[model samples]
Target chain A: MAWEARSSPTGCINLLHGDARNSTSITVFDAKGIHTYQPGWLYVPFGEQDPHKLQRSERRLLQRDIALLSGDAGNVVRIDPAAKQLQTADGQTHAYDYLVLATGSRNAPEEVSGFAEGADHFYSEKASLALEKKLANFTGGRIVTGVASVPYRCPPAPLEFTFMLEASLRDRGLRGSTEIHYVFPINRPFPIQSVSDFVAPLLEERGVQVHTFFNTETIDPEHKIVSSLEGEDLPYDLLVLAPPHKGQQVIIDSGLGDRDGWIPTDHNTLRVKGYEDANLFAVGDATDLPVSKSGSAAHYEGHVVAETIAAEVQHRPIRELYHGRVACFLETGHGQATFLWFDYEHPPKPPKPRRLWHLEKAALNTFYWQLIPPGRV
Target chain B: MAATYQIDKTVDAKGQTCPMPVVMLAKAIKDLKPGQVLAVYATDPGAKKDIPAWANKTGNTLLETVEEPGLLTFYIKKA
Candidate 1:
C-alpha cells in the first residue's frame, strides 16, 4: 500500500520478492501497477470469508505473484550490504536503490533425529506445504506443536496454530481422540513476562497441556518423537515445530550484521548502524530490531523507511522513530479473540476487550495474502 | 433534515490506550443531534477497532472508514 501510494509513472520503484533473492522469477511475482504486493502470493478478494471483516477489493494489499520458471539459482554468492546488490550462484548481479530486507528467517529442526525429513519437505512454504500434506491424514495420535528454540519469528504463531488446529480437530471430531501437547522452552507459554504472565491463566483455561522447561535438542523422525536437551522424550505422530531461527549469513559475511546474522540497525531511523553514507535500512526477519519479527513491525518499519527515503529524496530531514511498536490478535476458540500490543518497553500488553489491535492479525494475514505480488513490503 | 456540529479534540493518554478511543468517541457523540455527523481521527490505531465497535454499540451509522495509506480517517453518522 505504501509503494502503491508513492509509485507513479515517473517513480523509480522496483519491488523484489522471494525468500532468497537468487531466484526471483520462480518464487515471486512483481506487480508495479500501483497497489500492494508481495511474493508467491496475491490478495484474493475479501468477502464472507475475508479475515478483516471488510469487503473484497475495498482493501489494498501486498500479493505474492509466483511463476515457477527454469534456470533458477539455488544460492546467493554475495551481497553488497551498503550497495544493496546481490550476486547469485549463476553469477548475475541485481541492484536496487531502496531495499526491504524481509528475508523472513528459515527454520532448522532441533537435534531430534529424523523428525523433519523428506525431499518434498521444508521449513518454509514450499516445504511447509509438503509437510502439511504429510500430516493431513493424521487421524488419532499424539500431535506435538511447539518451538525448538526462543527468539523465533512470530512468537505467538505456534500458539495460534495450536488454537487453529484444536478447532480443526473439534470440527473433525478428533479432539477427544487425539492428544495435543504444546512443548515450549520458556517457563510460561512465551518468554516475555507480560505475554507469559497474561497467557498462563488463559492457557490453563483452554486446556492446552503446557510442558514448560523443555527444549527439544534432538528429533527422532523415524520413531516420530523428540528428546529434550534436558533429557526428556516426547513422542508424536505429527511434530509441528518452529525450528531454530538464524540470520542471513550473507548479511553477516558482508559485515553488516551481528554474530546472529542480523543487521545492526537504528530502531528509530533504521539506518544501518555505524554507517551514515550507507543510508540503508533493514526490515522483517533480517533486522536485529529489538522486537518480535512480525510482518506488522516490517509494515511499520516500511512506512518509516519510506518516509526517511522520501526525506532524503527531497533533501529534507528524516522524520521517523520506530518506537518498537507492534500489535497482535490472540485468537481464542469460539468466535472470541484477544488483542495485544507489545514491543521493547511493552512486552505484549493486552488490549481491552473492545479494540482493533486484535483485528491486525486477520487484517495483516490478508495484507500478506493480497499484497506481496512477488516481493517488497 | 440537516444537522451540523463542530468540535476540536486531541487525546494522548500515553499510559492509557484502547477503550480510551471508544470513551473519547462516546464523549464526542454525546451532544450530537440527529443528522449531525462526527469525524474522529486518531493515530492510536486502536480507534480503527474501537470506533467501529462504538458505532455498532450505539446503533449509529458508519458512513465510511478511510483507513488508508497509513492514516486512519473515520466518518460516522448519528443513528
Candidate 2:
C-alpha cells in the first residue's frame, strides 16, 4: 500500500525496496510436471498454464508515482531523536521521517546437517523449481515432509504441500506404490486444538502418516535418513523440509532487531519497542508479534500501519489498532479447500472443506495482486 | 522500428518496472475503443517480457514493437 499513499499531500514519499526480488510464478510454473497442480491458485497471479483448473486473471502492482530505491540497506542509524537514516550497501544514504521495517525472514538450511545438500525446499523460487525436477522423476518411494523449526512462514503450507503431494501421486497413479509421511515438530497436526481435531481424522482417512514431535536434529544424506532430536530416525527416498527461519541481517546489525533479528514491536500499535519516537513502525514477518507469519497476516498488518501513518500525516488522532487478524485457505486436493480466519481474540475454528473456499482462495490471490501491492488494502 | 499504425493513446510508462507498465497499460486500455491502439513506452528491463505476456494473457492484440536507445515501445490493441 506504499504506492497508494504516495499521492498524499502530507509529505513526499520515498519507498526503499530491498535488492532481493522473488517471484512465486517460478513455483507455479514448475508445478506443471506434477499431477493435480493448480497454477494461479498458489501464490503469484501470473497466468500461463492451468493444470488443476485454477481461475486466472490480470493482476499486478503498478508503482508509477512512488519514489522507489532498490538496494541493500547496510545500516539504519538514528541520526537524532526525531530523525533516522539508512545507508545502502552502494554507499547511498537516505533519511526518513518515519521508518517502516518490513524486511521479511529468511530460511536457514545450514542449521540441520545435510539439510542444505540433501533436502529440497519449496520456500524459495529456485528451490521450488529444483524440487519440481526431483518430483517429475520420482516414480514411487517414501516421500517425507518435515518442519525443521517452529514459527515459520505460512504454518499450514507444509501440511498443504503434504496433502497436495498425495493428491498428485494419486493423480499420477503412484498412490498405491508410494508412502507419504508428514513429520512436524509440534505434537498435533495443527497448533490450534480445534483445527487439529478437525484435520486429524481427515488426514487419517487420506492415509497420510503423521509423525509428531519429530524435531529435526540432522539428516544423513547418504543413507536418506532424517534423525529427530528425540531419537527417532525416519528413512525417506525424497525429503522436502521447511528450514529454520531467521530475520533479516540488516535489522539485526542496526540494533533495531532482537538477538534472533526480529524487531520487537507493539502487537497492537506496531511501534518499535526501544525507539523513543513512535514513527518507527514495523509490520509483517520482521515483527516479533505473536501471530502466524503469513502474507495474509502481513496484508492485514499493512492496513493498520497504513491507517496509522496516514493519520499521523494528516495530524489526526491515531486510532487504528491491529487485532492480529489472519485468514488463509488450506488447499486440500480433489478441488476443495478449507477457510481459516482468526485473531488475537478469536481462535480458529475453521469450517469444513468446501469447493467454495477454493474459489475464495483464488479470489484472495486476485485481491492480493490487484490491491495489496498497490496499497489499496 | 517505425510505427505501422496510428496510436490511439500513449501511456508513458517509462522508468517503471514489471506490473507497473502492464498495470498502466491495462488501466489505459480500458478507456479506449475496442480496436484503438495503445502505445506503452517503458524502460524497465522486465517490461519487454512482461508487457507481451500480459497482452497475450489478457487477449489483447500486440500490433507492433519499437525499440529505441533506452526505451521500448509496444502498441497493443484492445480486444
Over the stretch B14-67, how does candidate 1's per-residue lDDT look in tens digits?
A: 222343344445545656776667776656565666567556655778777665
TM-score of chain B of 2: 0.91
Model 2 chain A scores worst on lDDT over the 10 consecutive residues at: A23-32
Q: How displaced is residue A75 in candidate 2, in Å?
A: 9.2
Among all candidates shown, the one with the greatest TM-score: 2
Error of 1 at A365 (Å): 3.7
- For candidate 1, write residues A1-377 as lDDT tens digits: 11211111011112322222233331211222223222111111101132223222311233234221113242344657566565555666666454444444545543235545611222343444545555466677777877776556677767766765676677778788888888876345665666667667766765678786456666766766677643468888777777776776566667767656767777787777776565556666777776777656766666666566656555678677788887666665444457767665666666443335445545655565344322344
Candidate 1: global Cα-lDDT?
Answer: 0.54
Every candidate's lDDT: 0.54, 0.65
Q: Residue A33 in candidate 2 has what lDDT? A: 17
Report candidate 1's interface RMSD in Å. Answer: 19.2
Error of 2 at A230 (Å): 1.0
